[model samples]
Target: MSPSSEEKNMKKWKTPLWAAFAAALVVLLSGVAALIYLDELYPVGLGPRQPIPFSHRVHAGVKTISCFMCHSEAPRSSRAGIPPLETCLLCHSRIIRTYPYIARLRGDAALNRPVIWERVNWLPEFVYFDHSMHIQRGIDCGHCHGDVSRMDRVVKARKFQMGFCIQCHRYNRATHDCYTCHR
Candidate 1:
């Protein structure tokens, strides 16, 4: 083939290759965005293995314990706080006194050691959420928490990103003022 013909063939191949490259880049970027949305950039990765295997189903379902019974601060505070270890001991001190896990908890309590539980649900630092406000407005815990009473091990049921909260606000006709959440 002539040099001109060779150049024409190269350019033809280059166009298809460039198109393929662009398609691949878009696919890769899309995959990354999906992962970020699903993961929600938690300090602990999805479905974290807690130090002690706590069973929400056993406590909240079988025993009929209210969520606020353990997480007492949720009704009055901005944070749906992690229950202090003493909360567990209230019933555990007698109910399953000799169980290995209960014993371990007893030991930890004796030493006054804190349990650093892996967070199951979280929101970003910039967004301000008041658990008390939501509760007072009659939003169920399962609205964001996905029915922990039914779960043996709690997992993040959905993404807690901006769009998620915005959708709820829109559905409820709540104010979307920037300062309401942004501050």
Candidate 2:
């Protein structure tokens, strides 16, 4: 065969290989970036909308109420208990009755309709996070939940990723076993 023809053949063979490599690289980079984004959303909790604009800073810090007041059973159970209507009414039924939002809450309670608070900062369904255990073990709520008592809107300030949690565990000389977080 002519040398020119051989060179042309080689170029043709290499062209597809290069194209494939480029395509694979694009796919790989895209996947990596997507994973990074998902990691940011690790402890996926409530997204944007919350039922009532409850301010943690006002309720917990200004009022100096304990975390367990709203999450009454947090130290005793896996789930952080949502405050019942009566719980909120305990203060709101009289004190904040003039506030438009509090009036609405009072009306809802009177109607026997519960305020459906959108839970933010939730772990994956497969992952089990026990607030009781964490609280009893002296894991401050601020560690994983950021400074809730300082937040007005309660947006997620921490990336609840497995790696993030594990890093905390490592720093504190705690266990990072799969069983520790995941069910």
How well does each candidate superpose onto the true structure, as a TM-score?
Answer: 0.73, 0.70
lDDT of 1 by residue, 34-116 (tens): 87777754333236778888988899988899989988888999987888889999989888798888899989999999988
Highest TM-score, which number?
1
Off by over 4 Å in 2: 1-47
What is the per-residue lDDT of model 2 for residues 1-183, given as tens digits with 9 covering 90 to 100?
567987988877775778899999999989888877887634444345667788888999899899888888899999987889889999887796899889888889889998888777788899888889889889888887777777777878787888887887888888878987887
Minimal lDDT window, size 10, model 1: 39-48
Prediction 1 global C-alpha lDDT: 0.86
Worst 10 residues of 2 by lDDT: 40-49
- In candidate 1, which residue pairs get closer than 3 Å at backbone N, Cα or C atoms, i.e. clash? none
